[model samples]
Target: MAGDLGLWGIPVAIVGGAIRVSTPFLFVSLGEVLTERSGRINLGLEGTLVFGAMAGYGTAVLTGSAWAGVLVAALAGVVFGLVHGIICSLPKVNDIAVGIAMMLLGSGLAFYFGKPFIQPTAPDLPAIALGGWSDLPQVQAALNVNVLFLIGLALALVMAWMFRSTKVGLTLRVVGDSTDAARAMGLRPAVIRTLATAAGGAFAGVGGAYLSLYYPGSWNEAISSGQGLMAVALVIFARWNPVACFWAALLFGGAGALGPALQSVGVTKGYYLFYAAPYVLTLGVLIATSSTTRALSGAPGELSITK
Candidate 1:
């Protein structure tokens, strides 16, 4: 990053950073997509992301296995999800209010216990060398692919297919669209939503694992960088499609990497502007895609977000 690696290095750095940074966004947004699709929004995933980062790093430090840490992080998310689901399932409980409370609770618990794990070094996730044939060192570094990123990509494809073809997906859609209809069919909406929230939380947990165990490769209180919150908007921009979610995540990731990419090529002018790029891009996306006339094309009918 000292001086110029040349003009070519800018694109290389952006691509690399996009791949490296987008993993968490992809996972979290997908998780939110799952949650929102069930007509229950979990704004607390920010706290879930933080908790996962702390729990994953702490577990990795204690167990000497990154995978074990991942499992622990997922389990932690499941617990939080169960708590949210149960509370929100009660009569007159607001899902959004519960989510806010869960966020505070999850984050407070993480900050309290995560202090000891702040400085520990944990195992990093392995990456694929997709650029080995390239002579440029920048290319090789840029194309280094983490395994979790690949899994996220595959899961997006599978999710897309499942929503169109699977019985479980149809059931979720039914429950999301109308609780009364589900109850009439002898299906329990609470049970379905609870399970969906748990599964959504698991996805967010994996996103947390990627944050602490892969790209940044550390345990820190500020590891998430609002990616969890931003993911809620990302799901909206993607129209709740799993496949679209993946691409939107990459776009956000690339926007996030803009500052570092310019810096890598010896451009420091207005560096702070680059840091704010993602937020600006997010605003632009919201504006470009905004419509007050009708619900977003793919949004669930019973989703209470705007109503």
Candidate 2:
């Protein structure tokens, strides 16, 4: 597959595709990490992701600013997050079940509201060309990075630092690790979990924005392609570390590019198999990392999957 890129062209296309596809993964995985760390799991982010894509595309089409659309998308996600947070906080409620319900609700609402936007052309986020010195057009295109990708990188770094250094991060960690402990310390576990879920939703919403306003930039029903759901696996694989999430996203992104990269290199047979690369990778990671005796070392205590 590397040979198909024609010397410098090979790595360029794959790298470009990886960066393009990884943007959504980066944002969604980070968001999921935040929510899980707060002792909650939200499966409904898939719905939020789809809805955000619709909302962002529709807003950008109407308002003529992709950034405005992104803002709207984030707000929509916040609403979804708040709903999940509030519902899950009630006694005897199952967080996983609530997440499933929210997922359906978000997707349904987006489909209903997004019908008219299917064919519209919305403003896209701007790109920064970092490969200007390269004489190869392919290299330039591959290096033409999205602003959101850079932002995701910065966010990963910031999140890593915040989790280690900030009071708020410590509090969130405390709430996630032990609800009773949080209560003993006079902290409201429900409130903290609720807020964390909301923030997670916001991040996922931005991920959705990147989908509609960046790579595969368009409005449609089939836009998500499971990136939202895949993010859950990503968070787990990253061991709840933000920096690790970024690297994991890139790895997944590269896998996702395999089919295209292979085709670009003149390997036309079995192209569809390459499309399964990311999901296959996810499954492999799950199996390789799975355990029956105890939860992963860094898992938040209240997270349902670990239990």
The best candidate in terms of lDDT: 2
Model 2 agreement with the true structure over 142-198: per-residue lDDT tens digits = 889999999999999999999999998999899999999999999999999999999
Task: Indicate the residue-level lDDT of 183 in model 1.
Answer: 88
The sequence of per-residue lDDT tens digits that candidate 1 reaches over residues 85-134 is 88988999998888889888888898999999987789887899999998
Candidate 1: C-alpha RMSD to true structure equals: 1.4
Which runs of model 1 end up more than 4 angstroms from their true locations?
A: 1-5
Taking all chains together, each candidate's TM-score versus the true structure is: 0.96, 0.97
How far residue 258's Cα lies from its native spot in candidate 2, in Å, is: 0.7
* Model 2: pairs clashing at backbone N, Cα or C within 3 Å: 4-265, 5-10
- For residue 216, model 2's alpha carbon misses the true position, in angstroms, by 0.2
After superposing candidate 2, which stretches have Cα over 4 Å from the reference? 1-8
